[model samples]
Target: MVMKAPVADARNGSVVDRLVGIDLARGLAVFGMYAAHLGPDPGEGGLVGFLMELTHGRPSALFAVLAGFSILLITGRKAPKSGIAGRQAIARVAIRALVLLALGSILGCLGTQVEVILEYYGICFLLVLPLHRLSAYQLGLIAAATALVLPQVRSSLLSVAPNLLDPVFNLMVNGYYPAVTWVPFLIAGMAIARLNLNTLAAHWRLGLAGVALAVLGHGGSLLALSSRALTETSLWWSDVDGAFEPSKSSFIVKSSWIAAPHSETTLSIVGSTGCAMIILAACMLAVDALPRLRKLVWPIIAVGSMSLTAYVLH
Candidate 1:
């Protein structure tokens, strides 16, 4: 599934594996963020604008999922590390979380239009620490449960939490990328990483799963809307076009069926995740089907390899 990255001997004896598909996916996420943050408004760019609109919320979900996969890669590839190795892995992750939190907080103070997700990611990393060692089936089940359950839980908590917790908790609950719904993406990533993704069968299976999920999410939203006697007129249009409308920035979720970007609604999460899976599977399959394609897309692969740097600098 992934090529082992070469590493010079470190005193601690840690080595990292690199997957081209994952890198390619991360690179795309970085560019998607660019499109979302820097490209022309969806209504302005025409087709390109539409593509930009599509990147609105899905890229963040992709990034979060990859983060989970990378977390699994770091702790242990196919199995959990034990004893001294395990302790060291825990320490590395904890330190990384703290650093991200501090960096995110500093960025948050800059009053930028873009929502800072690093703090949320840091929190997610901490939360995932205990579950990193879980088997694929276990993580998959948890991911499914979270995808279905956490959105309602988050909604309930928000309804009651005008004075319950601190500012960070608010960010984790209702901010741009709330951990409550977003964590499922990570869990899904970890679960996928636990399996042997190198096989053709795996790729096909993942792709089918992706298609099913995408349909489930988008189709479910449509079905729910129709069943409730709600039509297109009741909902807002243009996720990208809406960026300019400050009043629309804070959306009012009329029901659970609304699958708007950044809503953290169940359908929203599922749709974003399905898109992520489809993209990732496609990338891996592409490289495998045409090895030369890998060399041609070296720039993207390189960008993906250093995603964090690419992210912050851009």
Candidate 2:
């Protein structure tokens, strides 16, 4: 669970000072990413693999959602209060996005597994500008549509030009999440943040609903993939040279929703987003239960605060 930030700081009253919890969440997401990348490969059928699958590839979704949440917290505060302040808020976000994008490019040259997230997140950050203005309902709609459409869209693109489907275009054309599908989730996160969710514990209904949605969403995706036996499609795609089909015994399907060279999949969308909410809610509960851990959360919070920078460095 990300920490609940105070509405404002009592000392200096700066917005940045109020964003400790947000920083913690972002920092932890990077930690998850680093652990997954640095850890030994959990073989396809092993429990380690399952754990890796859950943690290694999915933290980015949390980071992205938090990014959206930040936008709402920072911008919504001033949007209704003063237009000039709102514009400045937007510019702040834009500059951050640009900086991250540039930094991500530099990070990519290091040949690290974490490189793609910086690129993906930098893009998602830019996308938050227009989406920050959307209603919650609209944000939900966008999230749903993108999650459903992106896979199919890439599938279509792969069919049209198989050669172009190479890894060089994975961030845009193929799975885990191309730029098209992921931004909406951030928008949804922004919407969630805009609702003053931290103060709304009185309404357990939203959290309940989120849990239900997550269970159904993730369970349904798993069922769909298991039924299809499209578990590993990389070798098949590579073999055909022009056509792509999945393999029954392949590790790719069970391990990742996106196919390799990039391990992305339709199932990953369900898992990443659903798991994010589940983990967040759980974190919230855990923090409420154990005040002692607040001190422990600092390292993750620091990582979260400087996530983009650390991500670039990683």
Top lDDT model: 1
TM-score of each: 0.90, 0.77
Q: Which sections of candidate 2 miss by over 4 Å?
A: 1-21, 44-49, 77-82, 165-170, 174-177, 200-207, 226-267
User: lDDT by residue for model 2 over 79-100, one digit each (tens)?
Assistant: 3324887788788788877877
Model 2 lDDT on a 0 to 1 scale: 0.60
Full-model lDDT, candidate 1? 0.79
**Cα lDDT of model 1 by residue, 134-240, tens digit:** 99999999999999999999989888884656777676786778877789999999998898897877888888899888888877777776776643422222254
Residue 193 lDDT in candidate 2: 63
lDDT, each prediction: 0.79, 0.60
Cand. 1 TM to true fold: 0.90
Deviation in Å, model 1, residue 275 alpha carbon:
0.9
- Index of the highest-TM-score prediction: 1
